[model samples]
Target: MKKLYIDYDLFLRPAEKDQPHCSYVLRPGNDGPACLREEISFLFACRRCEDYPCVNSCPNGALKREAGLIKRSGFLCISCKTCSIACPFGIILPELLPYLAGRCDRCIGRLKSGEVPLCVSSCKNGAFRYVEEDDLKGCPDIYPMGDSIIVKVFNWLGSYGIKK
Candidate 1:
């Protein structure tokens, strides 16, 4: 399976309002035509950082840090805009607003095209890679946070008896 890799900086740019919203549809071999498995959700600002101050600064408990991922609880997000102000890397900005709905998207489409996400591809250091989660185990030093936020979010939701 292919995975999406994100370019954090590109995600911060404002979307042109006139741009058409494209959907990512998938067609399984058994399934008859293409079915809309999911939509291309808004790209969000990056949350990865060695010193993640924004995670703690969010008052609504919306920000979360994980290995290789920073997941936000959009349903719990009050959008008070505290996280945006607290990020030190300038990864979060006022114009890089969050989409009110949808799952955390890590730029899966770009990876399938033999390219990294825009931000990572543009990086001078070649910092990010879109690899299988299992493949990351051997390279622990890379993506040091490794999907911790994803697990945490699921656990948090489970604590409240939420199925998802």
Candidate 2:
């Protein structure tokens, strides 16, 4: 079974400095840009819903279900942004990226070796941890930028695209 965890230690903004000093399931990140981004993203993660509109919307079959998780095939993708459009929460974030860019495989290689994922292991601050998926119920999947932001932004920016 897959589990999700929250890193509470990274929440404090540098100015706040004083760590709340407790294990919290949900808290806003402090003023740091990286922490703030992670907090915002963590505030909105994958829903893993029964009806995956993102998968259904993929015309190239780039996205699929395997072992209770959504897997993406970058090679098969055409980067059409249909799956991004189909996702009600906009969590896919594939608009300006190449096809299959938004997929997260849950670090299968590390899990298979009975080790923690790189993201978790490399987290020197010890803020990373796993939690029950039920805790994140009802998270909105769509992004606020709308369906075509990926392509639209890339076109306007001209080669300096956004990074994940």
* Candidate lDDT values, in order: 0.40, 0.44
Total clashes in model 1, counting residue pairs 3 or more apart in sequence or in different chains = 10
- In candidate 2, how many clashes are counted? 16
Q: Write the per-residue lDDT of candidate 2 for residues 93-131, one digit (tens) a residue.
A: 543335223333444565677765444544445444343
Candidate 1's TM-score: 0.39
lDDT by residue (tens digit), candidate 1, 99-162: 4433323435754576544433433432233445564454422222224211101122234453
Native-to-model Cα distance after best TM-score fit, residue 125 in candidate 2, in Å:
14
Best by TM-score: 1
- What are the TM-scores, per candidate, against the unseen true structure? 0.39, 0.36
